[model samples]
Target: MSSDRQPIPPTRPTGHQIIAPGHTFATVSDKISSIVLTRRTPLYWFIPFLIASALLMVFLVAVTALLVRGVGLWGIKVPVMWAWAITNFVWWIGIGHAGTLISAILLLLRQSWRNSINRFAEAMTLFAVACAGMFPLLHLGRPWLFYWLFPYPNTMNVQPQFRSPLVWDVFAVSTYATVSALFWYVGLIPDLATLRDRARNRGARIIYGILAMGWRGAASHWQKYETASLLLAGLATPLVLSVHTVVSFDFTIAILPGWHSTIFPPYFVAGAIYSGFAMVLVLAIPLRAMYGLQDLITMRHLDNMAKVMLATGEIVAYSYIFEAFISWYSGDKYEMFAMWNRMTGPYAVTYWTLIFCNLVFPQILWVKKIRTNVVWLFIVSVDVLVGMWLERYVIIVVSLHRDFLPSSWGIFHPTIWDVATYVGTLGLFFFLFFLFIRGLPMISIFEVRTLLPQAEVAEVEQ
Candidate 1:
């Protein structure tokens, strides 16, 4: 490690200081603020931001065409009624789960390391949900009539098919999005106040001031803030399970052979968290280097997150084995064929690719050096994302493509629009993230302050 990486303090252990030594409360604030206020956007950030912007334009044009021409522009048809759009929806929703795990679940469990990473993780969650939320709305063929999915007083007097899993999806995703946004914004309040206090210009001062909502960092204010955060964490923990479980319901509730298993709920939830942690590492490694955040987000954090990826990935691997085993064990030929088709059918390459991506690659993480190394960790993270996506493709498209009647079997191919919409959401996610890094304190300033040794000594004295 370079000297710039971190200078160890004599009193502090290798893992201590969560924030490096030699930082006071003011310095912590200054350090994070310098990233946003003092530093110019580096070429590293600018190039990706520019690319994301260009892709956002492609997304807009693609979506406009989708609305104008209807669902026919995509390759979705009879046997593969739900294809790329639903796959992307599930994939994005899964990616969002790590945010909730880091922010809500770990907070409840009293993981102090979560402090440095949770702010950005929560932001990623909100954006991932945004990307996830778009697909189902667009899937509503007429989309303009999507409000009909809600309960409303109407002359026709129809309500959403309350029992349908897709309806459950509407409720689950919307509730998750709402809670995630609220949770993220509430966490931002204290940091926003920091920005407000430090603002050099009137415009920024006023904008951040308004958003700060009179937070003066008083004892009473902090008491109320902590109380609100605990309550929100309680609410959000269930959502971490509920949102993806309901998403899995979109498949398990069906009579389709591969989709009908009871294991789908936990299986999907594990996969969601699995992919989410991967994405966080994927984003964090590059970011830690670019923004010089290695000290704050240390190798310890990387090692821990990599351990999480390996463990949850093992669960996902179990689900894969059980899915195959149960399909073969059951006397149902349809179930048998769905499993076989996934392994040996027309899209066999995708199924095998998914296995390699999800299973083969993550095995490298068990080697301690690789898990702790950014380059190796980043490669594995990208593979996890690809594998999880291919997992969705296998589940939705492969199962649907070869169901029931032999005569009806057909393959689903994404049109330019399908590919564009998925890529566009990536563009949008990156764009939002770039804006986030630019405007806000990416680390929780107050939380990191709490980790300082002096704060702990003060608490002990009190």
Candidate 2:
């Protein structure tokens, strides 16, 4: 290893400095690229990969059984038609929100701290979206006919109902996926070129060379890369808010008691961001430790992420209060009953657990010590993820189980298959993420290099 590429001493960053002192352009590039290039595949990497792969098999088996035995294998009965699947769908979608917010919005704001973590965060977004997308298709009964949801010309002349928010999700998610993939790939071109040039193996160089598209680090290439990145960032900025808002419409447009509320849009978006940041911390904390990248992903990054979680958690808490208030103030007996049932009914445990998880536990982040502690941050992040999932469960299952007419009311229980399927998706997510870490630069090499003192001087001189 080159002397310049040596790891920085493990030291906690003081104040809000993004990167530690003593890093140069070469150090930044070499340090990040080495993870994907020259480093030996550590034993720890395979341990989780094997576990995730085992879970992935569970997902495949569950999916195959669903296809063979039908959606009846799930707990979806008459009144409780939407259960674990929809809850998992919404939760996964919400988890994806932080990536776009961190990568696009922060980039536009010129926040340099995002450079270290945005690559993996963006990958998380794509992977989460991929996981979320699977449920709607499986929920369609005929999983093979999912393309019918699209407004394509066909012989049957079947068109998706334009008024239905489910149909709206078809377009919204597809658009979000396309734009996110483009943005992610566009960002990777420079890094791909870096890998291509540095790889010792012939096959690795060829594969990366194809992905790099002949990027030569020219002045003109940099200008075009900057312009394209800015334009994509501009386009993606609105998607951070719009996609989840459209998702909320799936419930809001309904006349069902808990479902029909104006506040759902903003409420859902805030919750999405809240859960999304928690996931970033969950992924970041372990990754930094395992790779000995404390200097690169400093305490400053963890602090900022915790602060974001705190802010969004507060918004979600207020939304909960306001939701209850509106139900009482409007004197809507059905809405009131929905809220009452969530508190006192059979599923009340989930509701209260979510309350403590999303609202109560996260309040500890207000303390600077907790925000900077990696172990506490990981615990809080896991708590938030659970809280967010239960939040969806309360919103979907609890609300649907007991309608105004008692005759039609029914309890929704998640069968073994439902648990299997949900757990399977978790496996799928981690499996893809593990593959990503091994194959690509998890941090943006060129972007982080720009944060070096010499690069700043070069920019000024130019």
Candidate 3:
């Protein structure tokens, strides 16, 4: 190769040379505050908030009726005791897992792309978990005694059964929720401080300042914050795995033929991520458009997320196939019958819907053109979420409807309360998410700014 044609050596910056004037870290703090805080909240913010609030009121009314009247108002009966309540519980919990996976797991993996979305995803996780935690408690007809699920000294001298998967669910979900909140709040400290400084009024400043916990941009503070975050991430990874594993156990450990399975742990985890990411995309697309964050939450971010959705979609497909193979290989007549029932029996419509939504629609993402198209990505994400919900319904309802005893075989249906609450939960999730976006930064300003290429080069030169 000619000398001029040879690869040019990378230029090295000299020490203490000013690349640009007034480039202090404080400037970054100010820029972020300006982007997030507004003089008055936008009208678009009120739409989700109002709708969510209205739905939440309806949920309260329905729940009160359930408490006053009893579980009889629900569609639950013999051989179908577990209906929409448990389905909603599991589905919401699964959706909750996505936020932690994006925020904690990807952070440890050093996936730089996570910087743009992790904060909001973390918030989504917290709110989803909050919405999810309600179902298990309320599913107990007497919500008053729901606390008995926890281990504490009781007059009956009975301890919560450690052997029961439901108890395990109690512990796992509680731990996951608590740890996720701490992690999300800890990450927000620096950004909150930025807000504290930028607040136009004394009340807002005081509120943000207190929440900031006296955070300063000192090197020592960042070091400790990062170390704490890393430790929390380590703690959170296994917690995430165990939480969903326990959820799977709730079904798998049952003696019902269709419920028993060895493949549930990984399968459930993959499904959780798949649905969680779908919710993230659904929320992100709207927020990006609403907040004028198109540049920060860019097409590149959507493309990367679509790739993840497609990969997990395939994993779920594999789980579906493996379930079929195992059911056939076991040669248990009841198991085979249960599988057959799902495909061609009473609820075949729901079964086909699951396949079409979860397995087929996601395949579109395999096309590079489809993955990058914002409208297509949004549509596919919504489709995947619906499919995942149906998948959970299929697993729970189908298995329970036709357990070992042929005499117990029956079809289950949901009542108006069931549909109302499901819609209400969606409202709750979006309501919390809307508040988070309008009141706090939807994108992680600190993390995104750090991802700028110039900042990376500057850090290296230093």
Candidate 4:
């Protein structure tokens, strides 16, 4: 008997069939343009411009002081050479990781929620990297001859040692910054086109139009854009992972008891993500409120990000425990002493503060109530960032203060220039972010449109 079944034919598009209308995409484009271009009042432009200008001036003054006076102005001295500057460098670099992880990794994973925050997150990565890069240059006593770090044949007889972690860090950070900027700019083209069309003035229209490269929302262009984005995401994922690992190598490869450890790479990666997610939350909450993007950046986005923070926080906590266990297991007196010193030594306050902020506070996010509340999340995020900074401080200061030579051991302190430079970097990071928000679309309009329920259903039906 013939089976009562029909063969399923391949679904094919008909040339005459009407293409689905993209109202949701158009609406998101309008909303994004409104945020970037339309200021309700002069304060929209004035506040950011004023704040950024002030911060930039401070940064310039601080740098000039650093250049004129020299590294002697900072607190760095014998035995405790690495101080706030290096700590800030590592912290900022770690902060940069979150943006790439959110934008590139989550994009490749097809996590739709990433659309709400990826643009600003990517911007944060670029700015953070820029800030991070400044420290190493300034940390060098002779800032003018900093090119010695690079391998130039014939010009300098000494080539950069491939085995050195600092050398690896230079390559890794430069590559990450370059690739992240390219990925961010490539992703911005469509949104820039949206801005081009929405511009009210000739100057605005001309600038945005040029940046948009005459993009007309053509299907072919979208196809190529999507492909390029995926390839970049693929490249960035490994780059993100490797960059942090290389950074860890700077400490781990050293013979210092606390610094040399196999577990550092993962631990550092987790801490980076933990702090990075906290930063994203800190920035996102204020931005969503300020830009009237509550609907676009929904509670769902916060909840999802909270989960990421919680997961990474747990990893960091475990890393702390693992470091303890490894110290004990290795039966190395110096390692054990270093671990003990971190807990009950002179800088125990910093160490415990790290434990409380990075590990303890983040546990509160496990509760749905706390995670969903934007205010609480923002508070926790700040706490986490503080804790992360302290963690770095503990790692650098505590370990180095009482190293192999008991006679040479001493406490490290930040001088006026150190304080100014640290504070100035924050100003610079914010200055860049503020300018980015005012001048460019901070959210991905095209990606957000794809997240609308109606759009999802439409795609499913198709």
Candidate number that wins on lDDT, 1 or 4: 1
Clashing pairs in 4: none
Q: For residues 142-260, could you state the per-residue lDDT of candidate 4 as single tens digits? A: 78887788878765477888988898998999899999999999989988888898999889999999999999989877767777888899999999999989988999999998999
Question: CA shift at 424, candidate 1, in angstroms?
Answer: 0.8
Which ten-residue region of model 1 has the weakest summed lDDT? 6-15
Q: Name the candidate that leads on lDDT.
A: 2
Per-residue lDDT of model 1, residues 193-219, tens digit only: 999988887998999999999889998
Q: Each candidate: what lDDT?
A: 0.89, 0.91, 0.83, 0.85
Residue 77 error for model 2, in Å? 0.6
What is the lDDT ranking, best to worst?
2, 1, 4, 3
Candidate 3: worst-modelled 10 consecutive residues by lDDT: 9-18
The candidate with the higher TM-score, 1 or 3, is 1
lDDT of 3 by residue, 115-143 (tens): 76888999999999988887887789898
Q: How do the residues 1-462 of candidate 2 rate in per-residue lDDT, one tens digit apiece? A: 235853321111122357788888788888888998999999889999999999999999999999999999999998999899999999999999999998899888777788889999999999999999989888889999888888888899778899899898989999999999999999999999999999999999999999999999998777677878888888998987999999999999988899999999999999999999999999999999998889889998999999999999999999999998999897989999999999999999999999999989899999999999999999999999999999999999999999889999998878999999999999999999999999999988887776665553222454
Preferred candidate (lDDT higher): 1 or 3? 1
3 or 4, greater by lDDT:
4
What stretches of model 2 exceed 4 Å from their correct place? 1-16, 458-462
TM-score of each predicted structure versus truth: 0.95, 0.95, 0.92, 0.92
